[model samples]
Target chain A: MTPNTTTADPLRKAASGIAGLDEITFGGLPAGRPTLIAGAAGCGKTLFALTFLVKGATAYDEPGVFMSFEERADDLIDNVSSLGYDLPGLIADKKLVIDYVRVERSEIEQSGEYDLEGLFVRLGHAIDKIGAKRVVLDTLEALFSGLGDGPVLRSELRRLFQWLKDRGVTAVITAERGPEGQLTRHGLEEYVSDCVIALDNRVDEQITTRRLRVMKYRGSAHGTNEYPFLIDKGGISVLPVTSAGLSHSISDEVVSSGVAGIDAMLGVGGFYRGSSVLLSGPSGTGKTTFGSHFVNAACLAGNRAIYFSFEESPEQIVRNMRSVGLNLDSHVTAGLLRFESSRPSLFGLEMHLVLMIRQIDQFDPAVVVIDPISAFRGSESEIHATLLRLVDYLKVKGITVVFNNLVNGDQDDRNEQSLSSLMDVWVGLHDLEANGERNRGLFVLKARGMSHSNQIREYRLGSDGVTLIEPYIGPHGVLTGSARIVQEAQEEAATLERRDEVNRRKREFTEKKSAAERQIAETREALQREEAELLALETVDERKEQILTASRSAAATRRGATA
Target chain B: MTSPTTPDPMGEDGAEISDDGIFHFRLYVAGQTPKSLAAIRNLTLLCDAHLPGRHKIEVLDLAENPELAAQDQIIAIPTLVRSLPPPLKRMIGTLSDPDKFLIGLDYSRPTS
Candidate 1:
């Protein structure tokens, strides 16, 4: 008996057409089958269903039937108009149908053995009228509450699901999130469907983020993590960051760090074209300045760049950077550089990531700068997770990313340390003080695969941009700021004092030599004069000795006395 | 009120099974599944015991005519619709339990 292998499961998929959603699901919802999208209030359950139907009818050329159990047709259309979906027009053109089924438990009477044949007849007729391939039973559980709980209702729902499947129509049935781990308010809905997508709106630190997770997909593989989704003017956009693995291509070409000295510090005269750089520093350590330089350098090279500022507004960034000679206005005018500055508290980290990723893709920047990644105030693990995803995504795309992180104390900042390895080059900028003045010190913490310089350059944030001072060193450590000037002056003065002392000692020795020469000449003259007088006395003594010629013995005695 | 009505009295074999003197039972099914065949067989046996050729059993397959499912207000498969009775009674499911079935149609069996 050969086991049947002809598509035994026969899995088919339908693209939901929601951005990043299909990628996470590996495809869309199961085709020609019912998929349950469950969530709590205001979690975009209704909008998601509407978007699916609208996108289906518009993009896939497959007409759809929207059987709403909660909202009226007009309200649905009006509420979804902001997303630019023309439901009424689609309905008029026979591309879509909207049927609002309102059930009142108080006004209805259920005789014995009565099933929901009316709903089936209506749904069936609607499906047949348009030959629809897509169907949405929004808030399908509303009927359960209206009809009361019974086996008849449950069995009828099962029949309805099977009937839809048998008719070969892919359907989306939405329900309220049930208690605990239930996918739907009524547990039976998920069992009858082929796929179940759960939406959750979580608020932490007063910032809310909508996340989507595929609880179960019967046939196909899917992302298990709860991917964060955004509901803006356009609609829901899921950020499948982690699902998009690190399979993106790499680049070995070198690019400048915008500052020449900093580029010199890194190997290859700059950073790799797509490598990630972390410019970490304390507050006001010119992290933003370095970011501006990168943007400027990228734009000057005729490549696009996007700067996400979590601490300042766009105008404020432009205005602040103007003082540093980084004229970003022209780049903004030329559309080569984009500045997206938003307060970190405005949204959750994931939403910011969605916005950033969306902007990055739309702009297709060659370089991306996120100033102060420290703005995320989630749990340590959460921040790490976000940054990890951000780095991984940018790296895979071969888009160079520079994240400016601020570290407070000398202690190892876990947040910065956690993301250090993902960085291809980590440049730590510091606020160093030695002699009553603050200075900026920069060092390459690590540069992967590059023979980067190990010297710490004292950088200057001047009116014309970042410049690295010479590696001036002294006994007081690396000299910088006023300390450098003061030490140089002190050294110069000490050298001059040493020269003056040597010159004074030479002058005193010359004066003493002339006086000693004068003294020796005087003594020689005096000795000569005395020896002449003694010669005269010796002559007189010779005359006296001649007078006493007879006295030879006396001369000998005189000689002996002289001796 | 005791006499059953004879409306479109057609049986599975194109013979008139009811002529106002017979109880009419329309057993709706979705083709030849085991459950549908079992329902037809059980209904025929019950009718043979109770009415002794005084009842007409008409079997309708929804698979052949899905549109007819709407006409008979049929939702669940393998239903028994007693159309001829003054007060129309509909019993859904495979009718595996004869006691539940008889009681569902407002009938009492002779002492259990």
Candidate 2:
């Protein structure tokens, strides 16, 4: 039955304290209510219940009582010790109480009518002993095997749930999953109508992945998707991708693409901070080289970085990056860079996502590089879903992420296309075959929020680093490699011949002009000499004639001179 | 209740005799409920009929000491446990059926 709270007033939730679980449930399980966790054997139902109690005790200051019907108190404590749960310590501190109710069908004979009041007494006593706010009845269905009165047991089980609610303790009741399509073996889901969570441990392609789903939350708007959860040394972590909605704050800052040439292509000088970049290319197209460059740049900036190499080991990556002038080993030594390498086939897509998230959380890196993410073997949709979550998570944390995907020729473009939608930047690498040579080409297919170059530049990976050479674009289309070299050479020779022809024409014109000038000078000089000689001869004749006249006209000459 | 010094009717059977040849029965109940009273009455009658002057009955009401319920691993109320015998035996519910109750108590009939 639903509580008497007003519909407009939201249901109060008790924080489960499980990582990402609160976010998925929008808060947590309903407070002061029982949540049935049903799962098959080895699916981690007991562990989940224990985590709820332990987390409540340690984190929320909520004392808890664990009434296990299937395992003894000591055995339960021993079982959870591997998970680093200090059950004994909690018990000793008066923060928790564990009561193992052992019920054996052959140990007692039924004579008349009896109820499970003793169970209530034991549970009640333990709860009161610690003032526990949380209670866990692990696999309460064990009663079905230990008792035979079906109707009486069912009624008492119903009363037990009601009693738990009346006591106002947030309870977690774990049950065995029933046969096909049923939520629990005894249909306990019908009793605990507040919240129901189902855990599944499935093996796909030789890899086992554990998943948790909120099947029903009566009064809460919870994430209904099956979230992948991981059980590691740190306990269970659920990867609730949908929890990190598109509401995360964005950053206007930019981080370099690791390679200057790539940064040059991105008009903003780098990718946006907290943005996702998809780097896709065929095999041997230097995808890892680009990723390494980004990581190297991040580490160089004194920012922590994690490189998830799905195809190469850390040592191998360091060695290979050395050839590209990226010294990742030093960064690793400085504790600024970390490498997590594992085969894509080693885990399911969700498991890989959880592992990556865990590593990222632990490292708290400013940048993350999943080199050759296309190495992941799964359905296209599944891979897309996994990447979407990963990108969402990284973006929410404001951590720059680069995904290097290996695209096999043209057909693999479909996979990249589906994932590219989630990326803030997409750099496509390809091998251009020309003039009997294959040259690497890099181009920015898309870069959101910044104007990026669309031109495909010739990418060269030398010992120094990656350089983006401007591809020669002529009438015959973009040319790279030897073809570009040959085209450049031919253009240089034509320029040289044109320069020589212009020089020869200029020399001939100068010679002709100088010869014409010399001829004109000589003619002018001869003409001047002839005029002078003629004037002198005339002067001599005039002087001889004037000498005779001069004697006679001396007197007249004086008067003519005066005039 | 009779004292244990009195002779027992079927004491010759070695299986029914303990170190003191006295039957020790501890009845666990929640309170003075009808079932608890009936269980106590029925068990007392069965003891008197089968092993007169050779039995002792002790009643433990869980309502008075709820914490003691866990000591005997008691779930249902009106649980009768035979503690003094070599082999410990327990029977749940009110002892309505005498034959079944006797069998649960591991009591053997004497040969004529």
Candidate 3:
């Protein structure tokens, strides 16, 4: 039985302090068992080994022993120092021991009685002296060359593996890869270790990308994809691709799209808070216009906002929006809105991502706008992968995001659709000409949880801001730039003859009434002279009534006798 | 100097106390344990010899300062480090060979 065999469960596993690699390997590398890291030169083999030992010594409190078969101890320390690790200082602390074993097969002969017993003895002595729990054998390829024969080297390798296991110290044995089918020399050392990891430095279509994959891990489950990784000043960072497809439940708080009419088109008149929206259009097609409206509206609604601009600076954006009557100066002073503008080529893609993450984490803006994500295509090496990573990072933090994409004049592809597919909502804008002029048009392609108006509404930008008009060309044709439909309706109302005829008749009637008023005034003057004649006629009528009354009185006596 | 200086109790051959503010000192031992004790003794004598008034000497058993041993990057025991007076220097192996120590530290006799 091995010295640490009684535990059955190894308590001294070397925790690879990488972000997602540990989750893939269950806990970490098997404790006190040799693990082989096979890769080509410049594929991060040395870095992986050094990071393992340094991170173990610094982070996990596990003292380490590094035996370099290639580089001097000083060179290794200098190389890893740029990654923010203090290797020289740790060496000074005695918790970590580094030994350089230089092997030149040409100078030293390998006979039938060759063995690595002396090397093992030094390693064991160092480990005991410092009580090291982790060991790194930088490259075993040099040792294999010294052995000369494959069978003999293989036996020696097997013996060395048993020795490390018996000592109960987790070891990392690194080797350079061979041509094609095998990762390391003859694949002998990999088969002996409990875990095998292969790193690749590949150039595809003239674009160089580094990928890491777990080829095999005995009695364990691990991620199988070749994950993209970045080597920066802070050491190597791997972008775990598996979490890209993970699902999350969306929040239910209502958030404004900055325009009341635009929100009215949505059934709830708003979007779920923390949901991502995509505003897609062509150049000068009001993508930034829409985003500005959202930012201004968010500011007015008491929500802090951040706008990331690639096409224009904050001052330029403010000046342009001023022409459309959006006053952002007060909001800028109020500290409710922050506009960050930069040329995309100013930094590498990951640096931009890290900067954005850092800024958002510090500012903690409620709303974030990336004006025209397509600009990232020119700035990033891999557009879709980088955007997906950024989106994942934002979504994990539950930030409300708005992405503007420029779809160049009618040229659409799977990548555009993929970006649009990532959004919780998609708003498409276009310029259509109908009748005889060009008019602006808007449509909502999709809103995941809310029902929206499916009709293409016409809109006009005036002093009062964007106004949605009834579709003059009705639901079918292009409203193109001139707004000919509106001009046609105006011209149709102008060409009515009945209205002109009615106005003419009303004018003639008013003239006749004025003429009658003049005639009546003349008749009133003549009536002053006719008043005496009329009074004489009234006296004659009164006498006739008196005579008729006298006759009736005489006839009444006769009628009484006849009755 | 006005005050009469004390003689080094742990001094061996080739160790000399100078008049112009320089102290030459040596320690003797056999193995790791004795060497550690000798290093501590020799550091104390030198600290007292050169920095008479305001100085403190610390003795670290290598077995105890095992970490300190690694920190100083000590491969052999009974190492003496001249920490003060600028350009800190160290000598190992119980400092038994005083000529080598003085020459290694550039404090040998004046040729005048």
> What is the alpha-carbon interface RMSD for each candidate?
6.5, 1.0, 13.3
A515-540 per-residue lDDT for model 3 (tens digits): 99989998997896699789999999
Which parts of model 1 are misplaced by more than 4 Å?
A1-9, A243-248, A409-411, A493-563, B1-112
Q: TM-score of chain A, model 3?
A: 0.74
Lowest lDDT sum, 10 consecutive residues, model 2 chain A, at: A1-10
- Clashing pairs for predicted structure model 2, backbone only: none
Selected candidate, larger lDDT, 2 vs 3: 2
User: Candidate 2 on A1-563: residue-level lDDT in tens?
Assistant: 54633323448888998988998899888888899999999898888989999999999999999988888999989988988999999999999998888878887787877778888888888888899999999888888888873898899999999988878889999999999999899999889998999999998778888899999998889898999898878888888876367998999999998888888878789998999999888998998888899999999999999999888899999999899788999999999999999988888889898888888888999999998887888888888888887888999899999999888865657887789889999998998887678888888899999998888899888998898887689677888988888889999999999999999999999999999999999999999999999999999999999798878788787888887
TM-score of each: 0.73, 0.87, 0.64
> DockQ for the candidate 2 complex?
0.62
Q: Report the CAPRI category for model 1.
A: incorrect
> Every model's DockQ, to 2 decimals?
0.07, 0.62, 0.02
Q: Compared to the true structure, candidate 3 yields what TM-score?
A: 0.64
Model 1 Cα lDDT, one tens digit per residue, A252-327: 8988899999888877899998889998988889999999999999999999999999988889889999999999
Comparing 1 and 3 on TM-score, the stronger one: 1
Top candidate by DockQ = 2
Per-residue lDDT for A378 in model 2?
A: 82
Maximum-TM-score candidate: 2
